[model samples]
Target: MKNFLLLIVLSLYLHSSFAQNLLQPELEAFYNPALRPFYFGVASGDPQPHSVVIWTKIVPENLGLQQIHWEVATDTLLQNVVQSGTGEADSSSAFTLKLVVENLEAGTHYFYRFQHEGRYSPIGRTKTAPEGEVPLLRFAVVSCANFPSGYFNAFGDLARRNDIDAVLHLGDYIYEYGSGGPRKKKKNFSRPHIPNHEILTLQDYRTRYGQYRLDPQLMEAHRLLPFIVIWDDHELANNSNVSGAQNHDPNSEGSWEQRKAIARQVYFEWLPVHDNPQRSIIRSFRYGGLAELWMLDGRLEGRSPQAKGTGDPALPSASRHMLGEKQTEWLLDGMKNSTARWKIMGNQVIFSPLNDSKVFSRDPSIRMDRWDGYPAERSEIFDFFYKNNLRNIIVVTGDVHTSWAFELTGDPLNPSKYNRKTGMGVTGAEFVTPSVSSFNFDEVVPKFVTWEAKRRFCKKKNNPHLRFLDLNHHGYMTLTLTPERAQADWFFVKTLYEVDYRFKQKGGRYIEYDGNQVKKNKKR
Candidate 1:
């Protein structure tokens, strides 16, 4: 009898070990293993008073069917479970899981985990928004995470810091170009993307998302915090426009709508987001009594693309809209009605004044893809902010691949605005976070510091309320806010090609037009 019992016990133990080993494969692969119990990590988004969208992906045998189980707990160790449920992983969605967990305890941190097969995933964490008026809010505003150029030291660094309320990811979460996008070392840098070709089909899109999720640093970051994401052109094609894009070939690629849908599906499958396409990403979330975060969708409902030439003749009459009039109206309304101590817009592109003349002769191509290319619209947005008493408003942007702190003036269009000599302010503040592994300005600019100096001079000279511009370095920015002032710190990552997680030491860098300023919580 004893011998028989021991044999049964040994069999059970073996089965358990086999199940545990399943996690290792998901954790290691370049492609997403949906069965891995979130071995890639987990995240939550669109937080409300008592609920948020919980997201995790499950890999199956042949991108077929998958069963995903999720659980939420009140304690970090997941000791006392509060909520639990199961969902079928849609293969069409690349076996992604999105669980909308409601009725969570307000303003509290909760630990979560997903289970499939016999293996349990690593402990995942999330939080619910505060119920009523609360004074302080802390958010980590970040953007531009690319894969090839360097290490995600910034994300790894932020994971260790515990003071942030939520992570605001602006855009450029993934690069879509062939391995030639941007690299730290031109010769020995990137590997051919799994698709090995520009993405245009659903399969290609799914594969790209899978590759990015494999980044350990990204996984760690997702595991640690709730991410709020917005997409820029790279998610579809480079310099993407409403009708078409700079990267898509009319003859080679298929229909634009087909490509766009695939891109959106993959994005929804991979990330933790609220699944409402009709309701624009131009949504707002209030953090207790502290602030209201407005995330914008700058790509979809916009007008025509930027004018082509030095003065892309298109700029003059092309009805090309960046954040269509409706979304822009929504933003203005959010700013006007927001009563939180600080009002923040999770912007995608640069919103400050910029001039091509300030750029050096030997620098990378001056991108007309930013706000600099849309003067009329930019002016209208600024005018709205100025007209309203939107005092502590701050705009955090990504797409530019540089760190910039600008002193936004009331009138953004008035030429010869700033003195180009002093760092001052007018309306609110705008913090432009740098890229993840994108090239730093110094590496590409002819006389790096001189070019930056020219930018500073021209911005200040042409616009008075503008303050800072780095236009170099590849990393993320942390925004901390308080009842007194809102502060943002630019954090630079050491490298990106490898999955190493060491970031350079950082300091408290505040936005110039500061009130209710909050400093970076190094450990948070």
Candidate 2:
């Protein structure tokens, strides 16, 4: 009887041993450190209350499928591992790997990293959104990072900031153009593009992204914070719409459809963003009851061809649209149904109309690339907000390489129509972030005596709705949201030409919304 009991115990032990040995071969083979796979470092994005996507690119010495292992921990030391998984890095995705780690605590900061063979990647820090009630939310807003223009000092500054919750990149993640065009005279400009010409092919676009990702400052920024990004014109071409672009000549640069597909494909592959099945990057993120951010795709989703300057009388026609019918309806519905205190729109182009005719002795010329071109659609959105009695709507915009703060009125053509006594005609507020390095109005305009004064005079007189405009600074904006007010603080780099430039607070603006009325506050 004792021997029979011993035999049963032996059988159970053997079964357990066999199960453990089954995984040993794969585990032992994965620890080879000879292959330095994590070359581009790590990044995280599209964070939710319970999950976040962690990303890494493996540059294998040879072209084949490589198995990569990833792990997420509650602490920076990675001793308390919460989740771990293994994924494949193949040539299909340019060796880029993205893993969505789930079932995490809300409003919690996590440290994650990747492993290829025995080499480990740089640890990336990410945080999940708050679940119930958030007292404050802060985001660093940036855009239009033209690599050849200058160094990414703005990105470095953002990487050093420990206060920001996330980085909101409002498109132009990478430019398709090569060096020596308009930015030829930029001092200390060194990095040239990979293709060294206008990028049109799939490989060309992918190579451009790779070059930009390798920027030390940019990589460091991604390593530190999760980025909520959207694409603008430069990702595909200059002034691009749904069908065609000004920089993309179908007669010379192959089919527009093919080029657009490849660009979008590579964009998803390189960035740590969740690809929408619809191929549009338009999505929304909610921060408890503090703010609900709706990121809109204003470039490629469903934009009509821009009118020629502002001379075309059809600029205000209902036919022209920036965020086509479906997207517009989606935005309106989301805003109406949202329970958050602030409705924030992560828009690409300028939402407020800026007419130069009021200052310059010229026709009321507007850049058709912006919302001014699609006046009817803009009005439709405004009408919905007015009808719903929605308050605390703030549009954060990029694309234009200048910082601006404006009170969005009901009518751009007749700003005086709004009720000045009660502040009733205001639909919302708009804050435009300056470029990371892209040239602004100061760079393009010719140098002369009183140039600064003349530029200021033109901007102030032309756009009455504009409370502040900085045409020379190259930096980003910090948006702080609370239950009472939404504040935007603009920080500019001392110089983009220097690698170790300091960031100085240029100015700040705040909008306090009370019921249907809005009050503005400015700090110089």
Candidate 3:
């Protein structure tokens, strides 16, 4: 420990002048002595049948290129090595290295690690997709990790478990808000945004990612399991579309194009996902004949701006797109051609139509930021599903910061379109995971609204297709897919105020392979 401290002090002394000259003093805070050069730990993602992307970043003591060595093996001891390689890391990518290690066995567990100058990083575990007839698969679906909101107890809980295959992150991984932003100002919480302002430039974004990666629980989760991620509004900005964001100010914040480009560049640099030449995150992963996971890009790739208000004439416009033209075509065609039994979509926002107007008089307009905003496109998709006899479709979504289970149909209210008792006309099922630490309805209006009352009000009479809802609770959902059914189990942590690993299984919903109906499961 003393030697590590001395090394840290020496690295600071050698790089302090260079860091100041670069005007990035905040970046220095991320350098921890214990972790040394590999302060950010390690991560793996985007697993395929024969390949997976392994990532690490080096905090060099000197301003020079780094030679990062990596290896993959079937065991944690790394005795029987399967592949090994060396890569060059430089400042252009903030010293981050993401290499796709290819030519490996399918449906297998592989341990990987990086080395630099004889020092080694933490060993990371990743699994490759299966080729045919997978009987069982599991994933922890999570999103909306606000750093300043509270401790990442949800992540900590998930990290301690070893049952899941991968962590499916549906965006808002790093909130762009600073210390004094709209987030709750709690005196008890010790965590704060490092830069102390909204991230706009490349350095600011990079610093934020560094701060998030420094978290022990998050880093441990990354080290233990491979992640399948997709971005939503907060990755770029709040309520982001292709043209602009609700958080951006044109006059004060400079050009939106520049800021968006910077955010995108920094995101690709920090994450372990492979970058497409066309910059599209719309990709598909086939888990043999059991399931296919289609991760959608709803933020950057040609999303139309939200409707102006409840009375906005463009709310029902067929031209207004959510996944845009190319992505929509790709998704629909892929879903149709897919041979897997379960078509699981890693969605960003609420894909089903949700209207809380009749239940709550104050909240009107049906949440334009979600699929409720693009009624025409949603209807078109539902029509396609119904016409093509698509069954056993499941969507796991995040970004709402609340838990929900909905039976997807064209119109839930119309008895002819959807039968709530039998779930006759349901086209699919959607399972929405709550935030890791973001504020929910309970936190926002704790003074007046009660969780019990709100939950009672959210009944079948109001929202016919709604199966389950948890307005308060910060945790993740575990999704298990098999040949017979796909089940989503919601687990909630006791508190996020402190480091609490204790959690309870609250509820669950499942859909069988025979149909798209959502059925409730008793708590375990």
Q: Which candidate is the best by TM-score?
A: 3
Give the lDDT of residue 192 in candidate 2. Answer: 67
* Candidate 3 colliding pairs: none
TM-score of each: 0.85, 0.89, 0.94
Badly placed stretches (over 4 Å) of model 2 are 1-35, 358-366, 412-416, 419-422, 447-461, 515-524
lDDT of 1 by residue, 1-524 (tens): 99999988887786555433322233244544543545456777777879888777755443346787889998888889999988887545656788789888788888888887767777877778885667666777666665656667778877888887788888777777767464336556554555566777766676667777777777878888888888888888888767788888878887887887777777777788888866345678888777888888878777466566455566644255778888888888877877777788888887776554555334413546777667678878766765664567788888867676665663444544433233223555777777776666665555656476546554544544444555555667777776766677777665566655556535455543344222233465
Query: What does the lDDT read for residue 284 in candidate 1?
Result: 84
Q: Which residue ranges in model 1 land beyond 4 Å of their true spot?
A: 1-39, 62-65, 183-191, 277-280, 316-318, 360-367, 410-425, 446-459, 462-464, 497-502, 505-524
lDDT of 3 by residue, 1-524 (tens): 99999998888786876554433677666667777789889999999999999999987767888899999999989999999999998878878899899999998999999999888998889888888988899999999998888888988888888788889999999989876334455675677787888888877888888888888899999998889999898988899999999999989999999988988888888888887766567789988899898999888886899997668998889999888888888888999999899998899999987766655455554388898888888888888898899888898999988898888787987888889777789867899999999888777666356555465547677787888888888999999998988888999989888889889887678888877578887654
Candidates ranked by lDDT: 3, 2, 1
Q: State which candidate, 1 or 3, has the greater lDDT.
A: 3
Clashes of each: 42, 0, 0
lDDT of each: 0.69, 0.80, 0.85
Give the winner by lDDT.
3
Query: Alpha-carbon error at 445 in model 2, in Å?
Result: 1.8
